[model samples]
Target: MSRRAAASILVLTVVVATAIGACSTAPLDVGSSDTSPTSVPLPDGPRTARLPSADPIPVSPTPTPQLPVTVTTADNRRVTITDVSRIVALDRYGTYGTAVFALGLGRNLVGRDIATKFPAAASIPVVTTGGTDANAEAIIALRPTVVLTDASLPSANVLTGQLTAAGIPVVTGSAGRTVAGTDAQLRAVATALGIPAAGDALVARTDSQIAAARAMVPRDADRPRIAFVYARGTGLLILGGPGSGADSLIDTVGGQDAGTAAGLTDAFTSLTSEGLIKSRPDVLLMMTDGLASVGGVDGLEKIPGVSETPAGRDRRIIDMDDGELLSFGARTGDVAVALARTLFGRP
Candidate 1:
C-alpha cells in the first residue's frame, strides 16, 4: 500500500493520525500479517469432513445488527453511547489520552493534561496536570459525553461518582499500565465505544512496530542495566520498582531494571545519588524536563560517586517525554521502539 493510502485510513479511522509530513511514499512497511478471525469446526458428533454438497442447506440470511447501546458501568447506572460525537477525555494517564487521539477521538476531547503534546492533541484544551492525581472540578467543568482514565487514578471512585451525578459516562482501564494489559484495555475501550474493529486495527499497527523493534535485540545477550530516575522536589529521586510501568518497559526492551537489583516494589522508592552510583546502571533513563531542570548531564555527573559510574563515564543518560515514556498506554509501543533504538543503536 502507498503512504497516501495509509494516511487516509489513519485519518478516517485510526483516530490519532501520526503526522509524517506528507512526503508521498509506500505505506508503512510494517507488513501485514493475517488477522482475520478463522472459523472453528464443530465437534465430531456431527458429520465431519463431508464432501462439498451439490445442494446447499437453506439458512436465514442474517439478523439486524444491534446499534450502539448504553452500557451501565460497575457503579450501577445506565449511560447510552448511541453515537460518540463530543468527548471530554480527562485522561491523566498520557497513554489513555493518546489512545483516545489514536482512535480518532481527538476532535471530541475537550480537556487534557499539561504534559500532552501529541500533534493531534495540540488543539485540545488542557484541563488538568498529568498524573494519577486528577482535578474533578476542572474535569466536570468541561461537560464531556464520556471520560477515559487510568485504573490507578487517585480518587477514581469520587471522580466516577461526580461524573455519574452529572450524567457523564466514565471508562477506566489498566491499558496504559503495561504492555500486554495496555493492549487489552485499548480493545475493551474501543469495543465499548462501538468500534471494536477499528481498535483491533490500531493495535495491529502498533504491535507490528513494537515487534519490529524487539526483533532487532538479540534475546541471548545479557540484558542492559537500566534505571528510571524521577525528580521529586529537591535532592530526591523517585525510583520505580517491580510491577511499575518503568520495570515493564525495561523488561520489554530486554534491559535489566536497577530497582530489581535492590528488590523494590511497585511503588516509587527514594534513591540517593550514592545508591544510584552503587547501582552503576548501564543506562540512566529519566523524564526530559525533570532531567533538564536539575542541571542536565553535568549536574548529574556531579552527584557523589556518579562521576565514577559506568553510566556517567559513557554518558548513557537518556531523557524522554515524561508522559509517553511513563504512561504505559497506546504510545508505549512507540516508547518501546525509542528505547530499543537507544539500546541497540539502530540495527
Candidate 2:
C-alpha cells in the first residue's frame, strides 16, 4: 500500500476503535497498542473544578554572548549568523521566540510573531498578524540581523525569501509538538543565535522542572479520561492520538487520552457527536479563548455530542491559554503541574 493509503487505513482503524470504546462501559486504555477499553481506578470527585491561576516561570540569568556561528535548519539549509544584536523569532505557538528568550537572548530580539507571549516577549513588536502570516514590510523595518522561525508560518518561505534578499539570515526550525520536539526547537534556536551552552542550560532547567512535576502525580490515583476539544464557534476539532503535544501533556498529568484510545493517530481530527458521546470522556480540555468563543460552559453543553457525554453532564471542563498550554517551553513543567492539580487536586 502507498504511504497515504496506509495512513488512511490506520486512521480508519483508530476511528472505528474509538467509536466502539465510546459506546462501551469501560474506560479507554490509551497506553495500549491495541484500541480497547480497560478498567482502571476512577477517582471519586466532582466532575468539574475551577482551574487555578498559574504564575509565570522565573527567567534565568543572561548567558555570556556568543556570535559568528553557522547552523543548519530542519529544511537542510545552512545559515550563518554573524551578529546577534537584532533577532526576530516567529512560530504559530510562539515556541521559537519563547525558546530564544529562555536562552537569555531576549535583549537581542527586535521582533516577534503574534503568538510569542510570556516573559519579556510581550513588549516586543509583533510582526505577524493572521496566524503566522508575516507582514514583510513591518519585519524589514525592524532591521533584524537574523530571523529564526518554524515551518508553521503559512507564508514562511515568502517571508524568509524576502528577508534573505534583504541580506538577513533566516533559519527555520522544526514545528514538532512533542516533548523531544520542544528540545529540538530550543537547540535549533540556540544554534542559530550561537548560544549552544545557553540552550543546554534552558533545556536542563525545563526537563528538571517537568520531572519534578511528574513526580507529584499519584501513581495509585485513578487516571482521568480526558479529551481535548479545539473550538472556534462552530468549528470543532478533537486533539489527541500519538505523537501530539496534547498526548504528552495528558500522559504527564496522569490522564488517559480518549482520542488515542479510539484509534485516532493524527494530532487533530474533526469531532463527531457520536464519537464524542461514545468516548465517554470524564473531563474535557479546551483553550480558554476557544471556550469563550463558544459562549462558555452553557454554550459548550449545547453542542451535539457534548451534551450527552459524561463531561458535559457533569460540567467537567478545563481551559488553558491556547499559546501556553502547547508551547512546551520553559513553562511546560508548570503547565503540567497546574493541569494535574486541576484534574486530580494534587499539587
Candidate 3:
C-alpha cells in the first residue's frame, strides 16, 4: 500500500461515521430476514472460519448487468450508465474493485487501483500511479465505458471532473467507507450497475460469515486491548483512535479499542510516547507494509516508548496486509476471524 493509502484509511471511515456515534458499541444491522448460518459450519471449539490463501471471490447468482440505469453520485451528480462492458473501479483500499467483483462483474472491470491485493484482481491493468492517486492520463487511456470511483483518493474529485469533461460517465459512491457501511458500499455499486438482487445475495453471504466469526469470541474471556498503529517511517506514525475503522475491527473481535480508551478523540493522531503508555494495550496491531516501512518488528521496538508498554515489552505485535487490514470490504469477515483466532488462542 502507498503512504497515501495508509493515510486515507483514517479519512474515509471517519467522514461517514461521525453521525453514527460511538464506534465500539455501534452495530451493523444485518436485518432479521434469514436463519442463522448453521450451514456455513461453525468451528470445532478452538478454531473456526478456515479460508484458503488465495481468497477467491464467489460470484454466485451470476450477475447480468442491466445498464442504462440512472444513479446518483455521492457528489449529487445524476449519472446514467449505458455500458458496463468496460468498467473501471478505483479507490484507496480496492473496496470499489471488491464491490464490482462481489457483484459478479469482475470480468467487466478493465482497470484497477493500486490497493487491490486480492488474488483475483492480480492480472488486471493497474491505472493508479505511485500511491492510490488516480493517474488521469492512464485512466483516460483505457477509455472505459463507465468509471466507478470514490473520493478517498487524493485527486479523485479532480480526476472525476476531468473524466466527466471527457464525456465518460462517472458514478461516485460514498466519499469514504466504514465497517458499518460495508453492505451499503456493495449495494451502491450494484445499484449503479443495475444489479440489486446480486448485491443483496452477496450482502447476506458476507453478513453470515461475519456473524459466525463474531460468535466465536468467548463471552467470559477477558477482552484484550488492541492498538492499531499506522507507521510510514520514523517521521510519520499514527494511531487509529475512535471513529477510525480499527475500532470496528477491535469491536468485532471482542477487544477493547485502546486508542479510544486512552481518550484520543480524533480518528488518526500522531503517535506520542505518552499516548502509547496511556493506552496500555495488550497487543499492537499494524498494517504489514507499515511495519516493514519502520524496519520490521525489531525496528518497531526502537520507537521512542514502544518497548515500555505491555505489548512492546512482550513483543506482542500482530501485523496484517496493509490493503486488507482496513479495507473493510469483501474479505472483512475472514479478516475478523483471522484476528479472533490469534487473539483468543486455542482451547
Candidate 4:
C-alpha cells in the first residue's frame, strides 16, 4: 500500500517476469512437438514401447502413354487422323495395294480389289469379281475409314463424289512411270495414313532398287529396234505413243518401238502380221501374263503371217509380266532391265 512498498513489489514482479522469460527461451526438441518430459531409453516394462515403422510408400501404379497416329502429305500438308482401324482399297491399279504394302500399312486394310496379288491382301476381303469392276455397294458396306482410289480411272469423278458423300476420305494417286512421281504419290498416301516418314522411307528404298537395276544397263548401244506387240486375239496389235510405258521401257533398254515409225501420238492402229513383217523388229516383246491367253509362241507363230516376220523367224520374242513391266509404278526398271538382258545380255 505505501509507495516504497509498491515500488519494491513492482521490482519483485519484474524480476519474476524476467526469470520466467529466460526459462521459456530454452531450445525446443525438434523430434517431438509435445511438451512432455524428455525420456531416456528405458527398458520395456509391463507395456512394451514400440517405434513406428513407415508403411511401405504405397507404390503408385505407373501410367502408360499412348502414341498418336499422324500422316504427312507430299504437298507438305499434315493431317491428324484417328480411329483409322479399317480401310478399303479399290482401283484399276492393283499396284496401289502393292504400294500400300510397301508403306507397311497393309494390315490396316480390310478390303481390296479383286486383282490384289500382294501376300498381305490375300486374306483380305475382295470387293469385286473383276479387276476394274469393283462394286460400290460392297465397298460402302465394308464401312472403311479410308479408301485408296486410283486417279487413272475415267470414272474417278463419279466414284470420288460417292465415296465423299458416304463419309469416307478418298485418297487419290496416279501410278507414275518414273520413280520420282511414283514416290511423290506414295508420300501422299502415307500422309493420309499419318505415317509420312514411313512412306518416304519406302519410296526411297523402292527408288534406289529401281535405280540400281537401271544402272546395270550400259548406255553405249546401237539402240536396238524393239516393238511391244499386244496381240488381241490374232491381228489386233495395239501400239503406244512416245510417252507410253512401252515407249519408256524401250528407251530404258536401248531400243526403239517398231510403231515409233508410224508416229501415232496416242494408242493406235492394229498392226497386221503383214505390216509387222514389213516393219521388221529387231526384238519383239509380248506380255508373259497374256501368253496363256495368247496360247504361247507357237500360237503367236500360227497367227497367219507372224511366222514370216523376222522377229518370229529368229525366235526373238521376249515375254514378261504385263502389270510389272507396263504399270511403270514400282517395277518399271526391273522389267526394262530384264528385257534389256534378253536383247543385250545385261541386268
For model 4, residues 126-166, the per-residue Cα lDDT tens digits are: 77553454567787898888777664444666776687777
Give the distance in Å from residue 61's predicted Cα in candidate 4 to where it truly belongs.
32
lDDT per residue for candidate 1 within 293-346, as digits (tens), equals 668777776766556766667777776655556655556666676666556554
Give the TM-score ranking, best first: 3, 2, 1, 4
- Name the candidate, 3 or 4, with the larger lDDT value: 3
Q: Provide the clashing-pair count of each candidate structure.
A: 8, 4, 0, 2
Over 4 Å off, model 2: 1-59, 220-222, 235-240
Write the residue-wise lDDT of candidate 2 on 1-347 in tens digits: 23222222121111000000011234436675655334443444333322133223324566665778888887788888898889888766667676766677777889987667654667899887655568888888999998887666666788878888999898887766566565666667777777788777767766765665566555444567788776667664454556556778888767878788777767666678977876678888877767788888888888888878777877888887765677676556556666765665542
lDDT of 2 at 252: 76
Using lDDT as the measure, the top candidate is: 3
lDDT order of candidates, top first: 3, 2, 1, 4
Best-fitting candidate, measured by TM-score?
A: 3
C-alpha RMSD in Å of predicted model 1 compared with the true structure: 16.6
Candidate with the larger TM-score of 2 and 3 = 3
- lDDT measured at residue 270 in model 4 versus the true structure, 0 to 100: 57
Worst 10 residues of 1 by lDDT: 42-51
RMSD of 4: 38.8
- Clash pairs, candidate 3, are none
Candidate 3 Cα outliers beyond 4 Å, as residue runs: 1-51
